[model samples]
Target chain A: MDAAFSEALIALLPNLRRFALSLTRRPDQADDLVQITVERAIAGAGSYDPDQRFEPWLFRIMRNAFIDQTRRRKTAGTQVDIHEMPEALPTDPGPGLEARLMLDSVRVAMAELPEGQREILHLVCVEEMSYAETARVLEIPVGTVMSRLSRARLALSEKLGIE
Target chain B: MQIDDETLMALADGELDPARADELRRLVARDPALQARLHRFEETRRLLAGLRLAPEGEDPLAAMIRGAVTPEAPALPPPANLNRPPWVALAASLAVAVLGLGWWQWSGRAPDGFAPAELAALDGLPSGEVRRLESGEELAMIASFRDGDGALCREYETSGGDLVRVVLACRDDGAWQQRFAAVTKADGGEYRPASGEGSIDEALAAIGAQGPLSLEEEEAVLRK
Candidate 1:
């Protein structure tokens, strides 16, 4: 059963990384965040409720781990890394150069957005999670999820020059 | 009828009810403004989809997280307090949870086959111990007990911090032979494994116990 659960977590790596990237705004930091989240997950596994969906449980762990990492960095006063504010776009090849440019535009715009809004957008729009699921992941009210995501989408659209 | 941002966002994210969705579809068809608004959301979703961090192919990130660490984050730090490496700290912690779990096991009235002094020592043992492995895994022993057949068994747990698992492993030869395992229940902070206890009881019933092992017999069984 643990093996099955671990396999389930493996299946969620992409989604987890996507959320981590959205929160951290850099590939390396996102990877680090995922690693920390997994470490905390393993350490805290004894507390997991098997009856519930694994994704939200995991998202909660990742969110908390990200929070912990942020807190620690804040305490350490560590210098921010360059990759954190990455200007490089994601590697997915869009349909055309124009499409690629637009994707880059969205990526930059997404980076510019606050972490809270970006996280909601990734959960709702990119990962296709509903408002309730996104809310549960972020531990916010469903209405807050909707409002935040609406504002994020509007922001992304305006920044991308979408009509 | 006017649509709020929440409803509009829900409709755009495909979260609206079918009746409402169909009505919205009809509304959009008749209203180019609504259609364009929906299209904008869809187009943004599309553009974002193209920015997926993990591209098509085998998901290397899972394997990476399972195996090695990227340069950004060190795989794991050495356990605090002890100068020894992480695995050694884990071994120590396991001994600690085992004792706690050992206490939890003996605290039960059933024929667990552990002595009172041994059970009482659990209180002396520390709590909230975290055992880690060389492979970047963690262990949390929920409880452990011997079956009726006198097989020294342990009902411990394993976690990668993302998922917790409760396992029943009976001593066979020299190593723990796993008999049962399942995801740990995170019922708030304090968790009681109902199924895990059921498995331990089931193992005793299936194997047919000779009642609780005496002190000498338990020592002999555990030594193996």
Candidate 2:
């Protein structure tokens, strides 16, 4: 692997892990998504345009991996049991407990959202992607991205009990 | 323009054009209720931003990477095709088991060993002594002191950079003991201990500004 590619991969790990966790709502699965994305990116390093923003390309790969997994699960007739998910770390006496509880509520709220809304929310809010970039990733118009984001935000605000 | 949800989101995200943003700003300034509503919406976004995405116990990315990197092992030879006898296979299995056990034993993941340098650096300082290390790093050494709960409390920073407030009390045998420990991030990012806080002349002033320290508590921690 090229040195630049390796450096980029390491730097992206934290954000990629965060994005994956948002999608899967489970640390292990999120890590799996990130790992798969990295492996695929590494394997197809030649296909990547060095001039472009590496994040969007990498996100596309992660989204594909997630879609593939979802399809596989659907075919296998097996559902992911949220309760069986592994813990992220040891429970420390700090903001960790409160953070975890809030995260649980957020995950539940996210799951209740429509798939399109969820994807757009992840891309825009979590990933901090622009509407144009989100449009490109979702292959939809920028108007659609804005609409989805507005709906997602309203739904999330209601779910989280924000006035 | 009557600022709707889309416009509010755009303004919050800084996606609005400068002229439109200025207009919205003027509107918000004129209307307190609109400003309050905008503030609540912004707060909701901030709260969501702070939410943890990863649950406890799992690292999905690590697992995924491990799965990708771990090459599939070559298929084992069929039992019928193997020329080795049952005794030979059993011996091989035992050898493999022994190797695995030895590897586990040699792994240095145990928490028993403390870094000698760090421990030594801590040792020279007196109880309640706030010393700046050679690297200009300052640390507070608090001794177990009696609190309202009648417990001895020794507060210190954990190795992980967390400020731990502990409550300790003297037991029946006269040994100062820890009652409870609460880990919290230091406010205002102030990790450096205040100077002149440990001296006898400044002890009263220090206690007034900071807090008290126990003599035995200092000795007990130094022994660690």
Candidate 3:
């Protein structure tokens, strides 16, 4: 493998972990998902078109790997309880008490969102992927990305009491 | 203007074109309700952005991937060798700029930059023909085309030792000058030469290359 590909992949570890966490909702499962995604990406590196953005390609791989893992777990009857999963939010000491409380409410609100809406929201908002890029990663059309994102944002606002 | 939620969200997300966004901005400026609706999308994104995972130290998983891919063989050139002459460094930077990879090994000024066999292959072989030299290096001319300046250029692949390099050269002042080149280790299977046009297209765009010439067009151009 080329150093460029290796470096690029390494640089994206945090983003991959974040995306994986958003998908699997458990840190441990997210790590496992990231591992599988990286392995598949390296193995199938030949198929990656250089003209395309690397983030979408790698994110697509991670999403597909998550789907595979979910399927296998469903077959084995070992799915984790979504409600029991730990909060994926960070407890940054930098924020003041009031800001932290606001962040906590946002986290809880985000957790209550439907899986599809939450994933799209995290991909677009947290990861800062463009709508088109998010669509590619989620394997949906641009219209769906916009619509789903709009719903998620609206839902989030309702929960937060934002004007 | 009765802008829907999708368009409003798209505007807040910076996905809408400038003209539409400007129009929306004007409307929202005058309408408090419209501003409030737009604020919802913006506020949600802001809160979500605040939840981004803080950057951490080197992940062990990344270390594992790095170790697995890097073999004992020196697949990449040493840092010292990259201190090329200014013109070559400029060309190399252009290669890096286009490819986003520091794999271009464009040695300056042939007779030394190119092997005699490589030069012969480019001159004598037609596009889509492969020739193996006595030295055992396999050279394949993939395609030929004219740059936006109408300069004749050829894309070729050469594999020898453990590295495969794809190069684009344009004929200038009766001599073919290397414009772009990317080298990758042959064993990794990371780069497939036949599928390298995507990367080459960026280089072609950098040089403003027109589409590849048909074989007949290439032949007629070569005869001129």
Candidate 4:
């Protein structure tokens, strides 16, 4: 985690944060997830192969961290209060308020999606990770990626009144 | 020919081979249903693109992170016994997973009880400092950041001999409040440093982030 590596992680932070937010559904948790992922990435930096795309490798760590964290929280019964909800992504509020509202509606709908589908949608649709890359990041089969992605899109479309 | 949702999705994502994609394009030129399905897929992609959070407010946590990730920063030790069966587990993950709580933290601050020295651990000092107190307890700052609600928190530990307390604390109204903590003794009466995933990571995920501290914000935290 030298300056160069820190710079590299910073450059990817926005995307990494975005992916984490999608998974965590809140900026704060996303930030923490990003922090934890960076910790795991930096700690496991020695294990990273320079040949692989760093993004997926980093994503894998976040996914694993999410799993590890989620399992523990379930056991502990910690309650995240209303204050912990993620702020909607800031959009131009003037002319785009209605559009933003509609988008907010979609965000609400996305939040309703099953964790698996939501994750697939975020990776494939939001981050635009290839289905192949997605499978690798999620440690799922490629076919499962396509099926889950299809379901996520259909569900979102239905919820958003897009038919 | 009936177009399956999967094929339409592939066409929209440009995942099909060029030959098949070109053929579909020709079909879509004439087939109203195919065109509608493709439009649906494209629109879904567009709507979902809004999922990315815009950096609007000051990310008060950025600087702490920037300070923390340096090569000089304490590395999160690789989980001990990764290959070993899961003996040690996290405290609570439901705060992040089961409740499915969307991101947002309540306004105002909660009360906390830890001493000032303990509270300072949340200030994002680069890790790896091993400070030994007069009591012969070793206190270390593993990492720091503000949770989703903007409260500063630290993943830290205090150790003396056979007993080690791994703790996660967040500053609530300027005092350290412990959200999660656990103590585990070394197996067979031998003391080894603790390493691996624990309550801290789980607690933070549930806590959420307002944003990372911007460099200036980190400076401000340091100034305080």
lDDT of each: 0.58, 0.53, 0.73, 0.63
Per-residue lDDT over B1-224 for candidate 3, one digit per residue giving the tens place of the 0 to 100 score: 57899998999899989998998899999999998999999999999998885775687777656654534445443212111112222122222223333443332323226678887866767787789966676877877878888898888877676555678888887788888777644321222322243466688888888656767777777777
Model 3 DockQ, alpha carbons vs. true complex: 0.32
Writing each residue's lDDT as its tens digit, candidate 1 over B1-224 gives 78666676677778889999888788878888787788777877777767665556656545533432212323553212121122222222221232123322422323333234323222221122345544455554433345655556544444544344544556665444656544533322222222223344465466554333333444444443
Ten-residue region with minimum lDDT total, candidate 1 chain A = A80-89
lDDT of 4 by residue, B105-198 (tens): 2111232344445555455443444565455677775555578777766566666665555666777786667776655443222113342344
Q: Could you tell which candidate, 3 or 4, scores higher by DockQ?
A: 3
DockQ of each: 0.33, 0.09, 0.32, 0.24
Question: Residue B223 in model 3: shift from native, Å?
Answer: 50
- CAPRI verdict on model 3? acceptable
How big is the RMSD of model 4?
Answer: 14.8
lDDT of 4: 0.63
Ranked by lDDT, the better of candidates 2 and 4 is 4
Model 3: how far residue B65 lies from native, Å: 1.3
Q: Which candidate ranks first by DockQ, i.e. highest? A: 1
Considering summed lDDT, which 10 consecutive residues are worst modelled in model 4 chain B? B99-108
